[model samples]
Target: MAMTIALNKAGKRFNRDWIFRNLTFQFESGNSYAIIGSNGSGKSTFLQVISGAYHLNEGHCTWTDGATLPVEKVYRHIAYCAPYLELIEEMTLLEFLEFHQHFKPFVAGMTPKKIIEEIGMQAAAHKRIQQFSSGMKQRAKLAQCIYSDVPVLLLDEPCTNLDRQGIDLYYTLIDQYAKNRLVLVGSNDEVEYKFCTQRLNIMDYKSF
Candidate 1:
């Protein structure tokens, strides 16, 4: 079944200042979209709106997959990765993966070990995440975010701590795992969203 995330006249404000207002858009499954903007331009907030992490102040948002899905159940269908979202540093890479599976299953035939191996972090699988390097931590984040079996994938600054090799790996994972899903990348860097066919520049939607 096809899925869609629709917003109608949506608006949000913080401290009497509207970040974005009077926006209407529908995001369909099987397509990739880029939310481009400078830092503090509400790109993250906009993604959260679509992800049902935040509510609209003026309009409405809805998700539909054959039928409308309640907001409470939206998290089950979405996999989100953001720079600000922290992992449980106390858990090992493998332990974290095992813990996450209790909430969201990985892609079919994927085990925690396999996932760590796919990211080339098999050697550190048993090491606590707090011991991982910045790039390594980012890889762990991407492994969990991209490998999850979910229809909606939301990424914010996905390549933040990645190097050239890590960036290549990111694209590879996106190309292989993101087929036929709703992928939204929040970033201003072209490299981060180069594969996205559709683009929404946040500056264009900043109507107060």
Candidate 2:
């Protein structure tokens, strides 16, 4: 079944300060989109709204397969990764993967061992995440999002701490795993969103 997400006249505000207003867009399966804006321009806020992490202050967001799905069930279809998202610092790579799979299964043919090899962190699989470098932590975060068996992928500042090699690995993973999914990348860098065919500039939707 194809997945679809629609935002109907969506708007969000924080304490009388409007971020964006009357935004409407639809995302369909098998396509990739980039949400672009400067710092403090509501790019992350918009992605959060689409990911079902935040409620729109004045509108609605909907997720659908063949029929409209309930809000509570929408998250099962989404895999989200962001720079500010906290990882379990006390858990080792293998342990974290094991824990994550209990809630969200990996894509077909993916296992913890495979993930470790794919991320090139096999030697550190047993090491706690707090011991990881920024780049390594970013790689781990991206791996979980890219390998999850979900229809929607919401990535905010995906290359936050990645080096050149790490950035290259990210694109390779996207080519191998993100095809046929609803991929939305929130970023200001062109390199981070070059693969996206469609672009949504959050500044264009702002009412303030």
- Clashes per prediction? 0, 0
Q: Which stretches in model 1 have alpha-carbon errors above 4 Å?
A: none
Residue-level lDDT tens digits of model 2 in 1-208: 4799998898999989888899889999999999999999999998888888788899889899989998888889998999999889999999999999998999999998899998899999999999999999999899889999999999999999899999999999999998889999999999999999899999998785
Off by over 4 Å in 2: none
- Model 2 global lDDT (CA atoms, 0 to 1): 0.92
- TM-score for model 2? 0.98
Candidate 1 lDDT, 1-208, residue by residue in tens = 4679998998988879888888889899999999998889999999998889898889999999989999999999999998899999999999999999999999889999898888898899899999989899889899899988989999999999999999999999999999789999999999999999999888777864
The RMSD of every model to the true structure, in order and in angstroms, is: 0.9, 0.8
lDDT of each: 0.91, 0.92
